[model samples]
Target: MSSSDGTAADASWERSDGRSRPPPTVNTIRRIRQACTNCRHRKTRCSGERPRCMNCRRVDRVCHYEPYSTTNPPSSASVAANNGAAKGKSPSSLFPRAGVVDISRLPLATRKSRQSSPSHRLLSINIRLPPPSPQTPFPTCQVQCMRFTTAPPPAVMDHLIDAYFLHVHNQPYSYFHEQSFRERVNYGLIPKCLLFAILASALKFSDIEYFQGSIREATEAYAREAWLAILHEHLTVENNPTLAERTLTLLTLFYIGGRTSSGWLKIGLAVRIAQDLQLMREPKNTMPPIEQEEHRRAFWSIYLLDKLVSVGQSRPPAIAEEDIHVQLPSDEETLRRGIWKKTPTLHQLINWKSETESSVNGTFTQTILAATALGRCCRYVLHGREMDEMPPWDPRSDFTLLNTFLLLIDHHLQVETPSIPQIVEHYRRPDGTLDFQSLEHVVFARIVFHTAHCLLNHPFLLRMRLQKSNCKVPPKFLTRSFQISCNHARSISSLVEDAIASGCHVQSSFYAYASILAGGILSLAIHIDQEKGQVTDPETLNHYQKAIHILERTGRRWDHASKMVSLHCLFRAIL
Candidate 1:
């Protein structure tokens, strides 16, 4: 909430009313712009403290703050007007109320409720058109629907669209090419479901207005409207790609985690749609190269999401590596230029040799490679225990295979990826807009890389593997793996530190999960040290603090992030 109230000078001294009322002797107590959820619900004064406020502390609860949109205090003139049957009442929620023109009805969208505050904007939009014209291009039914559509004005859509490319257009949620999507929006050619999906997911980051108060509500509102729009749409071979895009967008609403999204079912639908379109295989006909890239990028985007959303969970990914046959996507630049180039398939990248490392690898290609490694790492942790098992120290074991795959990924990163600082610098354009897609690959690569390391050497996983096999493993190997996990835990924190310092924000809630998972390693160690009555390493504690810091920053935008902050502050290690 940017404000104009604080800068007026001599306000206290000038008692303009000219009654015997004098200025107060005490100075005003400054308050934060918004209160914590509990304080707001209780209608109590909130100190707006970090992590936990005084009221939350009193109740032994987590202090949560979803990004809020509050209307400015009404002036006396407007206050008087609100009482009358006036033409211009202030907009109530961020989006308009349903069936209220200009406070338009929702589109084909989802209506699933989340565990959040009720004081939220219903995600809806409206354009307030003149009486229907014969020249209107829409069908009569669509024309009727458009009058109640709650879509924002074009100017606001511009901001939300920009935010989408900057924040939501990369990693676990990449569905559209920047150039093509913007062109569609410019031409009024984008599907309502896709447009609203982008708006809903990008709303929290946009910080445009106070939708009555809760931005999350407004965001979820957009999702609901998009869902409504999609329901009436006829699903067919030609519409399968758009349907996949819509489903993936809905799944991305789960970024902050929690009950906000039905990721599994949505992603399954998206993946199956891509497979049905034969997106996994390269095109065989006279299809343009640009069209081929679109198909490849779309499929890989789903693949990237599958890899990210499935981590630390029990189920397998929808698109297995073996099932994918298309070449990986090209770089952002080429995609923007609508050009395609020779690229490696998933297998070629995974089975890389030093002599045959001649494939042209771009940022997106690197991201795909990193995601594949992450998938393999996850599989190793969750399902690598084959019935015909070998000793932990054996060369032919699952552990060894994981190590080998990790090395392959490391080699590719070393060969193709830019340094973190270089990527940050590259993100800043001369025109002042950020090239977030470029920076996203680096962020995703680093996050996935370190997160996989943390997952691989997780102490519980280590202990379970050893216990299950009952094999005589070398102490040195086990000791080194522990060292590796600890190093990567700190590495995860370092990634956050660098991201913040460089102003390259961690855009996804999935990235925050990495930091939390990394913190778990240190948390387990400190807990163990406490049980043994020994001193924990100071350096380890510092890294743990950094992890918490990222979570706190993310919490301001995301409720689940805020919830995690509350949980971490209590110092429990369900790592």
Candidate 2:
């Protein structure tokens, strides 16, 4: 053989000798079995320690292994046997029976058994088990049921309830008592529909945009659920319609938050229900003090709602003054202390002396009384004389109704005047703006009074203008009434601006209504000045602009504000 060929053979032999040989049989190294089922499902690395693996131990999961079986499939009869053996045993507890043990006691035993088991034993006994039932994902838990029906988490619910009481229930005309309401909510005694209504109303005032969206959704859901619940209860329940009254009240409040006309209709239903419950009449002597107080509160609340709706809508009041025999509510302290004092009627309250006074000095009760009186005057002005009955030809007959309303106004002023100075002293700020938060009841009362005054006198002023056109001199009372009405209009506009400047959260509807009324009057005054070829007062024009600004601000929260703005524009154009 040539040396080169020998060298090549030697080199091949040397390379073969230097390189390690592959396994003779090419035996496959089994992939190390994956960690237990849980760790594998979680896609986490597992220590592969037998029995309960490290990952499962850390998370307290049921660590399990699959048993190795031959590649040949099991017989159907063996499968049937296994199924039969598993009968009556829960899937979780299908291991060999040690005894009928309480599952509660298994945890300690499980830990000890897992700790004491030999590694070899754990590896040998790879008991296969069925997969766990599918779990609800965490996000799905948030909206498990209908969003409205689902109870909020306890902390969130508590916060909402607190916000409702703080911002809503403390309003001058609101009726809810915080302590009783909280107790009812905590005990889950409030019906779900009513609770949702309250939540929707409360959330309307939340500063958060998320909560505002929630309010819109919740309000729609509440309307559906409330109607259904009411129908169901009416069919299934026997007497006692107290729930109906409460549900109606909550529905009214929800509508009120939106400043919808539907709130007035809801309040009418609430009034009828209250009447059915005998809440309009004085409570019986035999009734418990708390029950009596509750009746008084409910009745007056309905009365307050009637006034607010009537004035806001420019409609006649649904509740009449004579029909309300229930007394004013007692102070919170008096009610809380369980002291039973003889509640007084409106007449008696007007005549109350220092010696005879009970603790009826509560802002809520006082405000209701003032509003009720103002409401009476408003009804007379709006609907007292049926125009249908009036002779079509006589302008003189119009003055007859005006004269009577003026007397009623005089009576109210006389009774209410004594309290006005005190209210002014308490609420007037150093900057001459009224601090509405400190005296919301008084501020609202004054606004209502002035609104009624302006409304009543406006017709007479129009009459005076017509008479002036006919070359008939206007009566002294007519001219005086015109001047007084203009003064009241200016006063209302100033008060509203002051309220806005002071950062008071007065009801948007109230301020909006007052602004439109005042603005209309001031605009009329400007038109009259232009007709006389006199220069328009810049101050009056400025006041009208401010009133319009208020309406625009109110439009953000109240639907009625937009309507009022449209109406004011039409009226201004006509003038």
Candidate 3:
């Protein structure tokens, strides 16, 4: 019965529709899913993976696996063939079209040579990044890409801004209109460049405990952040030119960066930008009164920088006083209240010798006037405008005219030289209010006033003036000049000492050198007295020591001051 049935089934199958029903391709002897088709063809071990195996995935092939039943078991021969296959090795060696060599079988020399060839190696890539630096943890690109949210807390920023305005803004650097700046700060509209720049310089003056121990490092760190912000702004490239000007000047006004060679360039760039905006010229009458006052303030600030940064005549001031058509800044009350008044010019002040005409100028205008006079003195000294045929002793000489100009400046400002120097007291009221703007004006006016006299009586300039002249200089003239210089130098030191003691430090950058110059002069005078066989008095020695001490304190805040302190020649007689 079985033979007859099998014969009938075989005949039916042979005559079956071969197109409709397909036959099993393999003998089905291999165990189910023991190997994938690709792996099996390469005689390699399979991971028994579902859907797609690693070997198939690597080659981008469609994967297929045969099914099994519990009722039926696979042969041991199939299992053995799969088990002995190569493990963890690429099956590319089995196919000529794979285009990858089994480098493990290659000789040592050939493998090493191939290993060194980037083109011949596998296509997989490896990337490595450098560790962060200790000083600047974030690169500019990293900060930009990662979005640095790590600025000083808003409270800290408020204090820093206060420090800047109170200590820094009062110097001739009063380009910022306080009302507008404070309004912008309240709105959180200030730029990071300007914000960070203020923080950088003001950290030294800050009372924040967070910045207490490491003032230098914190200041430098903020400066670096400000630098990054400035570079980032450059990408936007002058979208806010006023902000750019203010930020650069704020940085130039206090940070060490503004004092470097680069800072000098920044000064020129800033002044040029201001000039481009017609800040060098007077604001038109059609302009808003408040806006006109703003432009006037901004121009005066830049003008002061020009005067202060001029290193004698070797580096001439960018703003020629003759070229300046803008008026001096308004009264502090007018500026604070937005009440703009047109102030007078240097020429107008010089001509006002009439006793009946009380000057309408405030202390700030006096600062401008004093700085103007100082500019003349620097140019006079550095230009070596020696009356070669006529001695400086001549009453009609340019030197004598300059001396007269200084005295006229004193007269216009109504300056009374007090016997014992007193710090400016009105900057703070009875209830602990700071009239910082007024204070800055008064303090800076005094400093620039004294600095001018000190430079005028500088022995260096005196020698030059006497060098070229054939006239016999009077010993009395020389002694009087020396005494005047010593007196003014002492005055400068005393002003610094009393101001600091009163919790009102002078905020001007020029004070760094002014204090040093004063100290230098007093030291020389003491030694000169010693050379004349007179013993150095305790008061004289004490004054010199106080000057050095003040300088050391200044050095902690200003990099240039530190260098000045280190120079042995700066205090040659004492050293």
Give each model's whole-structure lDDT: 0.67, 0.60, 0.66
lDDT-wise, the better of 1 and 2 is 1
- For model 3, residues 1-575, the per-residue Cα lDDT tens digits are 69999999889988988885675677655444466544543456677678788866765545554333211232454233223332333332222212223444445675565567543323111111122344665443332211111244344666777887777776657766777776766655667677767777677677776554456655765665565566557425756666566666766765432356666777787787787777867788887777788788777777777777774457667777777777777787787777767577655666655433455347677788788888888887765443545566788876788789888888766555432234244445678766767766766777787888888888877887787675788888888888788888887887778766666657566787788878888888887888899988777777788778777877776778778888844447445
Select the stronger candidate by TM-score from 2 and 3: 3
Q: Provide the clashing-pair count of each candidate structure.
A: 21, 0, 0
- Name every residue pair that clashes in candidate 2: none
TM-score of predicted structure 1: 0.71
lDDT of 2 by residue, 346-409 (tens): 6565543424454345656656655665575565455533332342124555445444544443
Error of 1 at 351 (Å): 1.1
> In candidate 1, what are the lDDT values of residues 65-123, reduced to their tens digit?
64555322334543333233223343322222222223232221212221131321322
Q: Which candidate order results from sorting by TM-score in descending order?
A: 1, 3, 2
lDDT of 2 at 536: 86
Ordered list by lDDT, greatest first: 1, 3, 2
TM-score for candidate 3: 0.68
